[model samples]
Target: MTDGIESLLPPAVAIILALITRRVLVPLSIGILVGAATLASQESSGPLSVLTGTASRFIQTIDQSVRDWDHLHVLAFTLLLGAMVGVLESSGSMARMISGWTRRVSTRRGGQSLIGFTGLLIFFDDYANTLLVGGTMRTTADRYGISRAKLAYLVDSTAAPVAGLTLVSTWVATELSYLQEGLADAGIEATNMTFSVFLQSLPYRFYPLLALWFVFVIATSGRDFGPMWAEENAAAQKPRSHHKQSPAGSWADIFAAVMPVGICLIVISGVLVTTGLQEPAESEMSRWQYFGHVIGSGNSYLALVAGGGAGLIAAGTLAIALSGVSWELVIMGSAKGMLQMLPAMAVLWLAWALSSLTGEDQLNTGGYLASILNERLPVEWLPTCVFLLAAFIAFATGTSWGTMAILTPLAVALSINLQQSLLASETLLAASDMGLSGGSPSGTAASLAMSPICLATFSSVLAGAIFGDHCSPLSDTTVLSSRACDCNHVLHVRTQMPYALVVGVTCILFGTLPASWGVSPWISLLISAAVLWVIVRMLGKHPQSAST
Candidate 1:
């Protein structure tokens, strides 16, 4: 039975089952059972032997794909972030700071700007941005009658999207490393492409930056959409209530919460600088040396742990000093806060593991896709096709990082192939110009067919992936945003989609036309933004219409 079902089961079936069940152990078990039963049916081997062999293969595959040190570092950083957030929240320091600011601003328009600016200031880390901004600003937004959905949209829109675009951000280093490796594999010079070149290309990352700006513009201008409009309207229809009394917390309380985050940022920056300086003068360092020097030195993880630790200590001290809270109360609050984040951490780990499994060479879904597209797609359509493909994958994966990790190499490879084909065409075109000395007219036409079809496909892929992640409900930042604003999950999704779709369509058009027409991607993006502003103005007129 297992053999028959395994033989019949498609990869799509496997993906759907895995996603729907949301049970990592069950999905992995099913995958292994299917593989084993199929092998046993094909051969005369015993069931146990087949099962053992299949299990061994799976383990070996995982071992080959998993970067243990990278995983550990991610885990450490996540825990530290969660703990730090808990400490800050428990101290009520963030609340005090936010209250102080709210008292000074005291207007709805000012509140929106403050929230957006706060998101920008925490650009170094998306998780920090989401939690800090969300937790700190919820009361302020409520006071000003802003819908929780809108607040979540603002926070979510700014977090990962902004961080991904920033040159010195955590995402950049990871993305750059991946890009550099892919370039190296293609025998391209790494030094030829600096981080600055990537930054220049980032304006072309249409989805994220556009989404961020659009959200801010809409918020500040009092435009609303979908559930956001409904929520705000409903709030307006109800009798206005007095603002909640500000909680009692002194300036010292605010400092306690902020000091930890400040220390963490300072330490991480210093470590990054030192790491940059310590890098060998050579163009490329060995993978082992790179890993050993970075992880073995323990600077990055240490900075995070130390930051969280310091924050916890400071919070406790402040609680005792100012509020007369007992040590037990502080310790209990810290522990509870850490525990509260355990489920989210588990989800993070599962997502990471799934990404690892899918990205394996033997099981690479993106590579399979590249092969299919290579055969079926016209050379001219490659850029647009890759953009849409990456968008779909990122939406399904709920991670821009995972989407890029799988797609970037494949995009690079496709670009290189297209370039080679174009080079050959140019040679034939030159031959044809020389009175068909080397080839017939028909042959020249055939050679020139693919020349006009340039490969600006990678830019499209980047843009699309960011676009999808920007709106995806399953995305980490999206979840954080909703949590931050205390908004209903479905409401946040519904409200943000209109804005996201508009930006996405703009990006697609820019990618397809101007990008294919030999214009620089940066220039194309500027034009797209101009187009977006027109659309926003038109759609923003009836804020009430968005409620429907």
Candidate 2:
């Protein structure tokens, strides 16, 4: 049966069904069975022999995959991050920071600005962005009579979008390292493409940026979407009550929470810039040597440890001084906070495991799609198509980093191929010119001419992955935002989807279309942002009538 359905059912369908049914183990089993059945059918082997061989092979594959756990550094990083977040929250540092900021904001619009600004500041790290902004701003927004859904929207919108756009951050360092490895595998030089080039390409990341802008426009203009709009309307229709107590904290509390994060950002940025500029040696080292010497030798980890440790120490000191809590109570609170985070951390670990499982086969489904696209679609339409395809994949995976890691290299490869073909055509024309002038055309000129196209395609893929992650319900940041704001999970999803879709569709039409027409990505992005601003303004003025 597995063999029979192999051609009929798509791989994605199998994975999705398995996930929806809460039976991931079943899918892996089915995949193995299918592989064995297919092989046996091809080799004329008996069913029993096929089953035995397949089971053995599956065990071997699983063992080999498990042995590769050395590469799972992100898990360790996340654990440390969890511990740091626990310390900050337990010490009441984050609460004080939020209180101080919100106390200065007199109006709802001003409050929204503070939220957006905080999101931007925390963009250096997505985990920090989500935890800090969401945890801090929730109470502040509530004091301003803002709905939890709106607060969640603000936090979720800013988290991934801001982090994705930042050129000098941990997010970029991790992504760049992965992207560089992938490009190297394809015989491309990562150094040839500068960080400026990537940053310039970010305007095409329509979802997150648009989402951020939409939040500001909606908050200031008093417009809402779906359930959020209904909630606001209901709140406004109710009787007035006495003003709530000030939710703001003291200046001392704010400094304690923010100082460590600020120092970490500065240190990380300085280290990354210095390391990125180092020249490669004349002779290339082995894979292990390169990993150990260049990548692992960096002091960023030390910086993270130091920054987090300092934050814990400062927070503990502040708790004692400001709250006048006994040392025993403070220790007890910290332990409780750590325990509270365990469940969230468990979910994160499961998410990581699922991502790893999905990404186990490096067949480059995105690249395969790009190849089919090259054959079926016109060159001018490639960027737009790639954007949509990447969006769909990221949405399904609910992991932007995973999506970018898989799709960017494929897009880069496709761009190189497309540019080479265009250059060939141009070269043939040059040959005709040479024939008329009695001189031969040069092939080297053609190769140099195609570099721009490769750059454009790479940018498009990055943009698409971010767009999908921005709106994905399965995204961890999205989940954290909802939890932080204390909003209904489904309500948050329904409200944000339309805004994301509007921005995404417009980006596809304006952003990618302009790129296809040979406009510089920077120029195209500016124009796209301008266009988005107009649309957002119109929507803000006459918001759609919807219920929570």
Candidate 3:
């Protein structure tokens, strides 16, 4: 049950089940049960005891996950965020806003920009963003000769990056909580360092930032290549989306949409800083230090929940007052929105439970992996290795959050162990130039010095997960984006894959590999961006849509 085939069984089984059944919940449940059974069998008193013990452990794992405050917070945040989206949708604010925006998009460039712009604005939730932006802009994109694949690409590309990068989105609380759990498992016991760690990783997250710009470059540059170009050419002579007949929305509807989002951002930021300062400070600190402490100690979960509630109220209130939506109707819409989020929430819960099974002492997936990787994985290659591992897992499973849940702890543990092993040997001296002149700094200094590598590896997990999610045909977001755009899902995947690969390969070569070698992330990002630009410009051609 170590890091060999036995340790691989649960994830392997889960992935196989998923591939065969094409269902998320049941496969994940079976995987967790298998993992629990394995753990119980290892400690069984006798043959018959194994079954009862495994069942007991499986139930215990579920109960433990339910009782976990962090898990509860994530579930609450998802449902609340859903309700907020629901309110906006029901009140006609979102539809009205989209209609208003599409009126000015007379060209393919203009239409693509509108889609990217809308996707960026709806950073609160990727699911909501994908569906809303795709549905709204599909008609305009078609009229402007923008292919369904192109529209789907624009929608799918912007959704995850925007949500992942934004601090107050539904992705944040869950992402940070996993990081916290991972760090704890890895032996980094700093109190409430989730936000601080996230802040550190933000700039280092090269793929998401670069990917977003890639979309912008593709959109504004009027360039197409690969299957996308063929699709663009085909669609130029034909089109489909019905939004052309949709009427322009009133100003009240647009304002209702805008105000709620603005308020959500303001409230979440305000509450994060405020909540972090709730406990009395033991000593005075500089202004920057105080701010750092505040963010570091803040309850990100509550901040998101409060923001979601306030946004929901603001959207509903404005809809009732300005959009002429009845109060009862708004409430019903809210219910609908919350209900729409159930599928995603179910996936999230199963993922969290799976994380508990893998990361906890029950399965010790992280410990087992760390044990195998201690000396075998060079410290410098850790980032790239993790990036590939995460990408493979997410691609196979078609769930980024699920990938994060399963890999974050393992990545954290591996990186920390690699750091410790490197530092405890002469390898650290050769790499960091530690010697008698500076002397091998021991204790806290070594740990502090090792942080950059650790942070880079951590960022790789997220970056790689997004890459897999971006390209995976099995990904729910990909399906929803296609459906929202009224595009054939397989065609959407086909068109997007080439572009995604360009970005993914660029990230692997210039971003993850170099960062692991101690290159600054900013420089790596610049290199990756340049590489992406060359690929797009040299290979891409202007879209041949007759409508253009």
lDDT on C-alpha atoms for all candidate structures: 0.58, 0.56, 0.78
TM-score of every prediction relative to native: 0.67, 0.69, 0.89
The prediction achieving the highest TM-score against the true structure is: 3
Ranking by lDDT: 3, 1, 2
Tens-place lDDT digits, model 2, residues 1-548? 22132322223443454445433344434543444344445455787887777666455544443343322333333334445455566677666666566667665566667888888776555666777788777756655556667677778778877877775343554454344333432344534343434443455555556667766766666665556667655554444234454466767677666664565556555554456446463377886555443433344433444444454455566667765656776676556545654543333333222222222133233334434554576667777777787777667766565555445544554554454445555677777787853333343322422344545565566667667766778776678778877788877777777777877887777667776677775676667667767765665532223211
Higher-scoring candidate on TM-score, 1 or 3: 3
- Over 4 Å off, model 2: 1-83, 124-143, 167-174, 189-200, 223-230, 240-248, 276-372, 394-409, 417-466, 469-476, 542-548
How do the candidates rank by TM-score, highest first? 3, 2, 1
Judged by TM-score relative to the true structure, which candidate is superior, 1 or 2? 2
User: Weakest 10 consecutive residues, lDDT, candidate 2?
Assistant: 351-360
In model 2, the clashing pairs are 99-248, 99-249, 227-548
Superposed Cα deviation of residue 271, candidate 2 (Å): 2.3
Clashes of each: 1, 3, 0
* Residue 235, candidate 2: C-alpha displacement in angstroms: 2.3
